[model samples]
Target: MNAFAPTRTSWRPRSLRWQVMAAVIAINLCAALAALVVIIANARRATEIEMLSSLAIGARFVQETVERIADEQGGTASLAQLPLHINGLRHVRIRIEDAQGNGIDLAPASHDEADGDADEVPDWFTALITVPPAERDIPVVENGRRIGEVRVAGEASDEIAEVWEDMTSLAVLALIVNIAILAALYLVLGRLLRPLKTLSQGLQELEEGRFDHRLPPPAFRELALLAERFNALGAALRLARDDNRRLNERLVQVQDDERRQIASELHDELGPCLFGLRANLESLERMTAYAPVASAAERVATMVDILDRIQGLNRRLLRRIRPMSLGHVPFAAVIADLVADFEAHSAGRRFDFVSEGLAEHYGDSIEITVFRCVQETVTNALRHGGARHISIELRHDAASGMLKMAVSDDGSGMRANALPGLGLIGIEERIGALGGRWHIGSTDPKGTRIDILIPLPPANVQAESAERTVIQ
Candidate 1:
C-alpha cells in the first residue's frame, strides 16, 4: 500500500439549529422536573397542615357535644348522634365506641361524588403527598362516670386529589407554551443564519478563480462586516490577477520582438555570406575538374557539400526563431506549412490540417501564441507520446467571436500520475494571459487530445472559405 494515497473517512455533521433546540429541550425538561419535585413537597406540607387543623376543629366540636349530652342526660345515646352530626365533615372521620369495645365507624364520603369523571391520582403521586394520620378522642360522661368516647381521625385523600388535578393542568399548559417557544426559535434562527449560505456561494466562486465576485451586505451587523471584508479582498485579488496578466503579456511581446530581431539579423547578415562561400566552392570544384589536380576536385566537392548542409541548417534555425511569412501570409497557410515541415522531417508519420472560417490574420500576440502552442504539442506527441498520426483543426465562429483549435494524436496517453512538463506549463500560461481556456485529455482507444478556445476581437472575426489539407 502506498503511504501517499489519500485516506477516506465517513463524517456526519450536526446542524447548529437542531443542536441548540436539543439543548433547550434538555434544560426545560430538567426545570420541569425540579418544579414538580418542589410542588409535590409543598403540597405534602400543606396537606399535613390542613389535616392537623381539621382534626383540631373536630376534636373541639366533639368535646362540646359530649359535654352537652352529659348535661342533657342522654349519655351514650347522644354519643351515637355525635357521629351523625359530623358525617359530612371534610378531611376527618368521626366514630363512637363504648366500654364493651362495641364501636360505630363513620368513614369519609366517596371522592367521586364531588370530582366527577376526573382521573384518579397515581399511586406514586399519592404516596409522595400523603400526610401522617392524626386522631383525637373526646370522653363522654353521665353523673360523673364515663360512658362512651367520640373519635375524630384526619384523612387527606381529598386534598391530595385536588393537588394532583392542579399539577396535571400546570404540566399541560407548560408543554404547550414550551412547544410554541421552540417553534418561534426555529424560524428566528433560520432567518439569522441565512447569510452563511450566501458566504458559502461566494467562497465557491473564489475557488473557481472568479476573484472579481463580490458578496452582498447582510442585514446582521457582524455578517455585514464580514461581507464588506470579503468584497475588499475580492477587489484586491482581481487587481493582482489583472496585473499578473498584463505582466505575462508584456514578457511574451518582448520575447517575440527579440526573436524577430534575431531572425532578421541572421537573414540579412549571414544569408549572403554563406551564399558567396557556396558559390566560390562550386566554381573551384568545376575549375579543378578540368585542371585534373590530385584530389583537388574531390576536396572541392566535399567543401561544397558541407556549405550546402550549413545553409540548410541556417534556414531551419531561422524558421524556428520566427516564421517570416506569419503576419504577411494567410494564417491557415502558415499553419499548413508548419504541419508539412513536421511531416517531411518525421519518417512514416501522417499529418492533417483542417481550417474553417479563418480570417486573414489575428493580432501578432494571438497568432504567435497559437503557433507556439501547436509547435509544442506536436513535438511532445512525437517525442514523448510516440505518436504516428497527428491532426490539427482550427475553427472560427464569427458570431461568437471565438477561435477554437483541437490537436489530436494516435499516441500513448499520458500517465495517470504524471505532472505536466515545462512545455505544457508555458502553453497554459500563454493561453490564460489571453483570457482563453484549454483542456488536455485522453482520446478514444488510446491517444492524447488537446483542445483550446480563445476569444477574438470583433474586428478579427472575418470568415474565410473552409479548406482541408492532408499530408501523408
Candidate 2:
C-alpha cells in the first residue's frame, strides 16, 4: 500500500477557516442546549413552588371565610356564595359542600387568548413541570351543629402556560442572537485568515522552484512573524540555488580545462614518441630482413605490429578525452562526425544525425555540455542498452532562444526500478546549471529517449546587423 495514502482517521476539513467555524458552531450549540436544560429545570421548580404557595394562601382565606359565615344568622345559606369569593384566586380551586351533598365549585377564569396559546406548551412539558396536588379542608358549623366543608386544591396549568410563553420568547431571542454572532464571527475569521491563504500560495510557488517568491507582513502579530520567516526562507533558498548553479558551471569549466590539457599533452608528447618508436621498429625490421636469421626478422615484424596497435589506442584515448574539432568546426558538423566515428567502429550498427536551424557556434560552455551529453548518452546506449540503431535530432529555435536535442536508441528499455547512473546525474547537473531542463524516458516498443532543452544566449548585435546589411 502507498504510505502517503490517507486513512479513515486522517479525514479532516480541508480548510482552516471552515474547520474553525464548525468548531465554533458546535460549541455554541452545546452551550445553548445546556442553558435550555437549566432554564427548563428552574422553570419546573419555580412553577411547583408558586402552585403550593397559592394553595396554602387560598386555604387560609377559605377557613377565615367559613368561620365568618357560620357566625352570621344565615350562615348555612351564605356558604353557597363562598365559591364566588374565592373565584378570582390564581393557581387554586375552591369548593363548598354541605351535609345535603349540594356544593358550588370555583375555578380560576380561563384567559387562553389573553395569556397566550395553551397548546404552545406540550403535554410532555406540562407533565414534567407538574407539582403534587395540594388540598385543605375547612369545616362549616352554626351554633355547634355540624354543617359543611370548604376545600382548596392547587392548580398549575395557568402557571405552567405562562412559563412556557416566557421560555419560547427567550428561545427565539437567543436563536436570533446566536445567528448574528455566527455570521459576524465567520466574516471576521475570513478577514483574519486571509493572510494565511497568501502564505499558502507563496509556499506553492516555492514548491514549483520559484524561490524568489516572498510574503508580505500580515496584520496579526503572530502571522506577521510567520511571514517574516517565510520571506527569509525564500531569500535563503534563492541564494543557495544561485550559488549551486554557479558552482556547477565552474565545475564543468574546470573539467573541460582538464580534458583539454590532457588531450594537448597526449597529442604533443605521446604522438611524437609513438611515431619515433614506430620509425625505430620499421628501421630495425629493414636491417633484419637482409640477415640470414628468420627468427630475428619475425620478432622485429611482431614488435612493429604491436607499436601500430599502441598508436591506434592512443588516438582513441585522445578522442575520448576531448573533441579536438569542437571549437574549430560547426557544432552540428562536430556531432555528425561523432556519429560517423561510432558507426565506423560498431559493426552492423546504424547511427542517424539530423540538424535544423543551427548556427555555426554557441558559447564554449553550451557547446561542450551538449557535446558531452550526447557522447555519454550514445556510449550508454551501446555499452549498457545494447542498442543497434541510434538517432540524434538537434534543433535551434532562435526566436525562442532555445537549443533542443533528442537522442533515441532502439534497445532494451531501462528497468522500471533502475536509478540514474553517474552519467545521467552529471547531465542533469549540467543542464540545471544552464537553467535548462532534460527528460529521459523509455521509448515505445523498446529503447530509451533523452530530451534536452538549453536556453540560448541572445545573438551578438554586430552579427545580427551584418546579416541585415547583407540581406538589404
Candidate 3:
C-alpha cells in the first residue's frame, strides 16, 4: 500500500540457477504474504469482538453505578460525578450525556502505537498488515429515564502489538526454513548438473577432432540416452574421415602408376624409332652432297630439315611424358628447361613465369602435377587461344598447406557458351581427383584467366619417405 510494493511486471534472471532461485523466493514470498493477510484479518475481527465486549461491560457498570448513587443521594447524582473516569479509561474512549444530550467529560482516548517495531518488517509487509479500527455506541439509562450514551472507539494498539509479535516470529522461522531449503536445493542441483558438464566437455573434444571420445552413461535416463547418441555420431564421423583419407590416397597412387607406364612406353618404344629416323636422314643428306643432280640435293636437304624438326618435337614430348628430371634435379631447373623450349618454338608469344616456395622438393606426385598443369595451360594459351602474352603465377602457401596457381593469357578468349576443350577438361579432372579445386576466372574477349588451388598434405606427410626407400 506504500512505496515498497513489487512492480506489476516482475523481472526474471537469465542464468538457470538464478532463475530457479528467484522463482522459489517469489513463490515463498507470495505464500508468506497470503498467510500474513489471513492473520491480520483474523486479528482485526478478534480485537473488534473483545473491544465491543469491554465497552458493553463498561456501559452497564456506569448505568448501575449512577442509579445506585442517585438512590443514595436523593436521585440527583451528576452523571460526571458517578465514577465516569472508572469506565473506558484503559482501552476505548467513552462519552456520557443526559436526556438533553449534554456532554460529560471523560478520560482521553489512547492513540495507536505501532507494536513489535514497524521497522522490523519491510515497508510493504507493514502496509499489508495495517487494520481499520472498530467504533460503537451504547445507550445508558437510570430509573426509567434516559441518562446518557457511551461511545467507544476501539484502538488496535494492544491487539495489533500482539499480532505483530506473532507475525515477526513466524517470519523469522519462515526465513530460516527457506534458507535451509535453498541450500539443500543448491547441493542437489550441483550433483544433478555434473552430467551436463561432462556433455559440454565431450562436445568440445569432438570439435577438436577427437572423434573417439566416449561419454559414460549418466544416472538420469534422458542424459544416458543423449550420451549414447553422441557416441554413435562420433563413431560415424571417425569412420567417414578414415574412408575419405584412404580414398584420396588410392586416387593419388593410381595417377602416379599411369604416368609411370606412359613414360616407360615412350622411352622403350618411341625413343629408338625416332633415333633411327634421324640417323637415316643424316645419311641421305651426306649422299646428296656428293650427288651432282641439283633436284636430288634439294630433296635430301628438305628431308634433313624435316628430321631436325621431328627430333626437336620428340625431345619436347619426352619432357612432357616423363618429368623424371624433377626427381633428380631442382624443380626450378626443370621449369627453366620447359620455358626455354616453349620460347624457342613459339617466338611469337611471350610467357611470364613466377614461382616461390619450390626450393625444397616434394614427392613425385606433387612435382608431376605442378609440371603438367603448367605445361598444358601454357600450350593451350598458345596453340588454341593464339595468345600473344601469357602470365603464369605459382605460389605455395606452406602455412596453409596449399599450392595456388593463376594463369592468364591475352588472347581472343573463348566465346561465351563454348564448351571447354579436352585439355581444360583433363586438367580439371586431375586436380579434382587430388582433392583440389579450379576456376575459370574469365573467358571474355580480353583474355582468359584460370585459377587453380591444390591442398597439399603436410610436408612431413608427403610420402617422400617411400620414394627414398624405393631409390635405395
Best by TM-score: 2
Stretches of candidate 2 exceeding 4 Å from the true structure: 1-11, 74-77, 100-103, 107-117, 290-472
**Per-candidate TM-score against the hidden true structure:** 0.52, 0.58, 0.47
Clashing pairs in 2: none
Model 2 over residues 430-460: C-alpha lDDT tens digits?
A: 8988999999999988999999999987771
Encode model 1's per-residue lDDT on 370-400: one tens digit a residue.
9989998999999999999999998888778
TM-score of 3: 0.47
Clashing pairs in 3: none
lDDT by residue (tens digit), candidate 3, 1-472: 5454453224332545656777888999899889877987787677677666756665566556666767776765556675443543444555666678877756433232332343454555445444565556556555656677656565445555566778788889989999999998878777777888898999999999999999999898988999999999999989988977766776677578657866876677566656766665776667677766775666566666657766675686578668658889866566666766788878776877777665456667767887888898888888787899887777666667777888899887777898876567668777977899998856555888989988887752332222110000
- lDDT (Cα atoms) of all candidates against the true structure: 0.81, 0.78, 0.70
lDDT of 1 at 200: 86
> Which one is best on lDDT?
1
Instruction: Rank the models by lDDT, top first.
Output: 1, 2, 3
Better of 1 and 2 by TM-score: 2
In model 1, the Cα lDDT at residue 141 comes to 69
Q: After superposition, how far is residue 123 of candidate 3 from its true place, in Å?
A: 9.2
